[model samples]
Target: MLLTDTHTHQYYETDPIKREELMQRCLDNGISRLFLPNVDSASIELVMSQVKVYPQYCFAMLGLHPCDVKENWQDELNTINAAIPQHKIYAIGEIGIDLYWDKTTLDNQVKAFKTQINWAKKLKLPIVIHCRDAFEEVYKVLLEEQDEDLRGIFHCFTGTLEQAQKVIELGFYLGIGGVVTYKNSGLDKIVQQIDLKHIVLETDSPYLTPVPYRGKKNESSYLLYVAEKVADLHQTSVENVAAITTENSKIVFGV
Candidate 1:
């Protein structure tokens, strides 16, 4: 069973000496591919470099994260726009509202999110959403700005069943991650009702590490933990989870 980690910052702080070792560990554990989501202009080069180093195993997505939204948001978007043709980006992602951290730039975040959505539509690429504590706000913008041709995954989705349905109705797959393995997480409840084909696997590493690895650094190798937890939730096998989610990923990422 070849598993795909559709969303992970494997390139985040990736060191030359340990990069191969870390990625090999993931490969050995069934993770055949890892997609790195861009955060801003600052991290694009590092992400691009990592993709070059392991072109066969690594794929990169370009976008300015909502948290990075600020006064020069347009300038940041311009950088992402220019980078699009340079790299074969898998998607435009890790982009959307992040009201959990800061609200000072809420308006700017919406504008940036909408603008980026337009770019994604124009480029004919899927998107990876990063909604947090702003589902309603995110939904509002998605309803208003998302083009009919646009589609993708909602990364790190921890919302209610209703919210999941809403995203699904909008034509996005739920990006299940480490949060699914949490003891008190309600994601498992909502996920039990959703079709496996509408789900995709992710790590969002080096963050949201699953149980047993919670409070520790996350990696692509730990994706098995999340897959196992989801399988258990669905009363299925890890291989089944991997197969279905990998297929779901291919639909969204085309890779």
Candidate 2:
């Protein structure tokens, strides 16, 4: 089964020696593509290094994460904007409003989110969103900015069935991860309700490790666990899940 991890931060591993080791492990496990999303200025070089080291297996996206927005958010955006013409970014992403950590930054977060969305539209690239405790805010922004040109993935989606359907209606894909394996997460119901075409598998590693590896540091190889769970929930085979989601990711990233 050829699987694609739509999201992972293996690049954040400062240890070069160990980073390559785990990345090779991903390749061995049939993870043909790994998409890395930029977190902030500090993470640019680190994440870009993954694409440099393994050009075939790794791809990147450029954008300022919502949590990283601050008083100096504009400066941060300027720095990333300058790098745009120089690098091949798959999408504008890991960007959206994150109100879970600090509600006070909502205004700045919204500004940053819209700014990046504009950049994506101008570049004709899809976006990869990172939303937390701000679905209403996210939906509002998406409604305003969405057009036939606007498309992307809603990474780490853990919303209700209604929200899942709404995202599909808006022409977006839902990124499912380890949270689906959690008991009582209630995401299985959402999964059953949504078609496999609108769903994609992700690890969000080194976070959201699936069961049997829960609470442990996640890796791209762990994406198989998520695929397995998704297959089980949809009453399908693992191979079928992998094939379909891989194609879905290709559509989202335009790879």
Candidate 3:
């Protein structure tokens, strides 16, 4: 029962003992692969350090997050690009537009998102998007840039069924996370209708913990809860959910 956590911040634990414990917990639960998305320039070292320690389990992505877009976004991009010196990047991601926190930076976020989208295409890598309260904006950028070379996952997706179908049409996958397990989130209805081929699972940990563990700090091991919820929605077994979504994650990351 090998499960894949396609998005998580496992490097944030900091403490060596806690970090090892977290890794072990993931292994114990049969989750051997974890994709770490770049949050910003500051997280580059932390993420790479974890990748260094667990090269077999942790994969990395590169990009500026929407919330991190500020006046000096160009400099941040340069820093992220510089880190590509010799490292393997699974995707150009956790990047996209987010209007929930600060609508003031919407323009900068869009600009950054486009820049990263182009970067992903140029590198022939998939992108992991972080869309929040701005699906239309993200969709517009994707529409303008959609091409044979364009492909990626809409990470932490919490959108409408129409949007999900559109994303599939755009050659991307919907990354389902803890929100699907929330009561009345309505994501279960969509999950039931959406085929497993276009769906992937993510933890986005240290955040978005599932119902039983909601309001608590999330971890990669808790990814099982989200998988269980997906199984319930699909009326299948947790093992089946793990097998199918792990395959979907591999399809996106090509690992």
| Candidate No. with top lDDT | 3
What tens-digit string does per-residue lDDT give for candidate 3 at 1-255?
Answer: 999999999889989999999999999988899999978999998889999999999999988999999989989998998886568889998999999999999988988899888888888899999999999999999999999889999998888999999999998999999999988899888889999889889999999998898999999998988988899888999999999999988888889
**Lowest lDDT 10-mer window, candidate 1?**
141-150
Q: lDDT of each structure?
A: 0.91, 0.91, 0.91
Provide the TM-score for each candidate, comma-separated: 0.98, 0.98, 0.98
| lDDT tens digits, residue span 1-255, model 1 | 799999988897568878888888899999988999989998999899889998998899999999999888899999888988988998999899999899888999998998888888988899889999999999998888766777998999999999999999999999999999887888889888888988999999899999889999999999999999889988999999999999998989898
Which ranges in model 1 have alpha carbons more than 4 Å from their true place?
A: none
Least accurate stretch of 10 residues (summed lDDT) in model 2?
23-32
Which stretches in model 2 have alpha-carbon errors above 4 Å?
none
Model 3, runs deviating above 4 Å: none
Error of 1 at 1 (Å): 1.2
For model 2, how many clashes? 0
